[model samples]
Target: MATSFIVVLLFIALVGYTRLAEAVSENPTASQIRFLLDEDAALRQKLHTRIQGLRQSVSTLNASIVPCSCPLPTTPAPRTQVSYTGTLKSTMSSLNAASVFNFTGDLINVGAPYTPHDAHFVAPVSGIYGFSLAAYMSPRYYVYIDLLKENAPILHVKTGHYYSGSTNRQVNLGTNFVLTNMTKGDHVWAKYSGGSAYLFGEGVSTFSGFLLYEL
Candidate 1:
C-alpha cells in the first residue's frame, strides 16, 4: 500500500510540471516585454520629430512669402502750355491804309508759333488764348490799332489827344486781355488804322499771347 501511494503522488507532480511549462511558453518573457516597450517609445519619438519638422517647414514658408500690399507707381499725364512775347524795334509813322504791324524783336517765343516773317501767330493747337498789346505815341499824334483774327478785327485799341490844343505829350495805349478761342492753323495779328498814325518802339510796343487751355 505504501509503494502505491508514493507512485500516485509522483504522477500528480508530473502533471503539475507539464501545465507550468505550457504556461511559460504561452506568455512572454520580461526581457521581450521591455524590448517591445522601448521600440514603441522610439517610434513615437520619431513620429513626433517628423511632425515638428513639418511644422517648422510650414512656418518658414509662411515667413518667406511676401505680402502684396504696397501701392504701385503711376505715370503722369503730358503737359501742354505755349506762350510768346514780341516787340517792335523801330518806329512806325504815317501808316497809309490799314496794314498789319510786324514785330521784329522777340523776348520769348516758345514753340515758334509767332514768326517775324509772317508777323502773325498761327495756332499750333485748338485752345482758348489770351492776347495783349501796348502802343506808345508821342505828342498830339493819333493811333488806332486793332487785333485782327484772319481778315476781320476782333478787338480795337485807339489813343488820341487826351488834352485839347497842340501839346507835346506822350501817351500809352494798350489792348489788355483779349481772350479768344482759336482752332489749329488760325492766324492772329495786329493791324494799324489808315491815315497819319505814329507808334513809338524800343520795346515800348509789345505783343504777348499764351494758350490758356486746350479744347
Candidate 2:
C-alpha cells in the first residue's frame, strides 16, 4: 500500500510541472526579452510611418510652385505718321526760262547748280519711306539724266535721239523707273548723267521725291 501511494504522488508531481511550463510559455511577461522585441518592432514601424509622411509633405511643398531666373523683356510700340525721305526742292520763284521748271510738281523750285542736292527732313513719324523719281525725255535731244542719293548717282537713263534722228522735236527720250529706297532726312536729287551725252528736260530741270510705305 505505501509503495502504491508513493508512485501516484510522483505521477501527480510530473503532471503539475508540465502544466506550469505550458502556462509560462503562453505568458508574454515570462520572457521579458520577447516582450521588449515586440515593443521595439512597433516603435520602428511608427517611426517609419512618420518619416514617410514627412518626406511626402516635403515633396508636396517643393511641387507647389515653379521658379524662374529672369523676367521677360519688353518691346517698344511703333509710331504712326508719314515720314518724308526725299530731297525737298526749295524755290520761292516760278518755273521760268532760267529756272526752267526747276521746281517739284508742287511749284517748289528745286533750285540751282543743277546738281545733286540733299533735302533737310524730319521723320514725320517712325516709318519706312520710299523715294523715287520720274524723268521726262524730249525726242529732239539726246539727254543723260540720273537720280542721286547724297550726291551719289544711282539712276542713269540716256537717249540718243540726236544721234538717231535730226528732228528738233521731242522724241522718246525716256522716263524714270520707280525707286522706293528712302529714309527720313536721306536727301535725294538728280544730276547730269555725267558724260558727253547732251540731254535736257523740257523745263531744263530734274526732280526727285520720297515714297513712304507701310504694310
Candidate 3:
C-alpha cells in the first residue's frame, strides 16, 4: 500500500513537469520576442533604403540621357557642272566635205554628255558654254572645220595648204575657241564644212567644251 502511494505521487510529478515544458515551448521568452521584432524592423529599414537607392539611380540615369540634335540625312542636288573633251584616234582617210568629224577617243568626258556614236555633245543643262577645236591636216591639203551648234555653223578654223618647194611642206594646225549660250539638250559638234584634205589624228585633232555658268 505504501509503494502504490509512492507510484501515484511520482506519476503526478511527471505530469506537472510535462505540462511546464509544454507551456515554456508554446510561449516564447520576452527577450527572444524583442530580438525577433528588432530583426524585423532592421530588415524593413534595409529594404526601404534599397528601394530608395534604386529609384534615385533610375532618376539619375533618365536625367543624364540626351536627345540627338544633328540634322537628318538628305539627298544631294544633281550636279549641274558639265565638261568633255574628245579626240580622233585614227586619221580620216580622204574624208568628204560636209561631214561630221567623229572624235572616237575620249580624253575627259565629265557628266557623260558627249557620245562618240553620233559624235555630238548634248548639253545636260542650260548654260553659257565654251567650245574649242584643235585640228591638224595632212601636207598639201587645206581644211575648214566648223564648230556647229544644232547643225548650224557657229565657229570656224581653217588650215592652209603648203607652198610648193617653199621648204614648208609640213602638216597644218588650226585651232579656235568660242563661247555661246546653249539650252539643255542642244547638240554641238565639229563638222568638215569645206576641205580638200584629211583630218590628221593620233591625238592631233580634238574637240572640247565645258559649261561656263549655268543660266
Candidate 4:
C-alpha cells in the first residue's frame, strides 16, 4: 500500500510541471512588454522632433521673402501747359527798318503769357514748343517775316510779287510749323524785315504758339 501511494504522488507532480511549461510558452513575459512600450515612445519622440524642425525651416523662409515695413510708390500729377494765338488788327508798313509785328488781337491765350500790347509769347516753363504764322499783302507788294527767339531768327517766310497782269493782285505767305526747345522766360515773336513790304493789317495775318511737352 505504501509503494502504490508513492507512485501516485510522483504522477501528480509530473502533470503539474507540464501545464506550467505550456502557459509560459503561450503568453508574453513582463520584461518583453516593457521593452516594446519603450520602443514605441522613442519612435514618437523622433517624429515630433522632425515635425518641429520642418516648421522652423518654413517660418525662416517666409520671413526672408516677405517685406517688413516699406511704403508703396505713388504716381505724380500731370505737368502744366501754356499756349497762345493772335492776329493783326491793321496794316503795318515799313521801309529799310525791321520791327516786331504787333499781333493786337488775341484768339486764345492760356496761362496769360501772351499780351496784345507786347505782341509776343513768353514761355512760363522749360519745354518743347511749336509756332506758326501767316501774312498777306495787296498787289505789287512784297512780304518778309522772321520767327525770332530771344532776338535770333529760327525761321523765315518771304514772298515776291506775282505778276498776274493786274495791279490789284494779292499774295499770301506763311510758315506752318517751327518746333524748338525753349527755356523758362524765353521770348518768342515775329518780325517784319526791312523792305518795301506791307503786312496787311487785316485779320488775314495770324501768329500762334503752344507748349508741346515739358522738359
**Residue clash pairs of candidate 1:** none
| Residue-by-residue lDDT tens digits, candidate 1, 124-157 | 8899988998886665676878888887787777
Candidate 4: how large is its RMSD? 18.8
Error in Å for residue 125 of model 4? 1.0
Relative to the true structure, candidate 4 reaches a TM of 0.61
- Candidate 3 residues lying further than 4 Å off, grouped into runs, are 1-78, 162-171
- Displacement of residue 82 (Cα, Å) in model 1 is 1.0
Clash count (model 2, backbone only): 6
lDDT of 2 by residue, 104-152 (tens): 3333322221222333223232345444444443444455556565666
lDDT of 3 by residue, 4-46 (tens): 5445655665665556556656777987566655655665575
TM-scores of all candidate predictions against the true structure: 0.61, 0.37, 0.59, 0.61
Those runs of model 4 whose alpha carbons end farther than 4 Å from true positions after fitting are 1-70, 95-98, 160-170
| lDDT to native, each model | 0.74, 0.45, 0.78, 0.73
Candidate No. with top lDDT: 3
- For lDDT, candidate 1 versus 4, the one ahead is 1
Instruction: Give the CA lDDT, 0 to 100, for residue 149 in model 3.
Output: 95
- Candidate 1 has an lDDT of 0.74
Candidate 4, residue 4: the lDDT equals 53
Provide the clashing-pair count of each candidate structure: 0, 6, 0, 3
What ranking emerges by lDDT with the best candidate at the front?
Answer: 3, 1, 4, 2
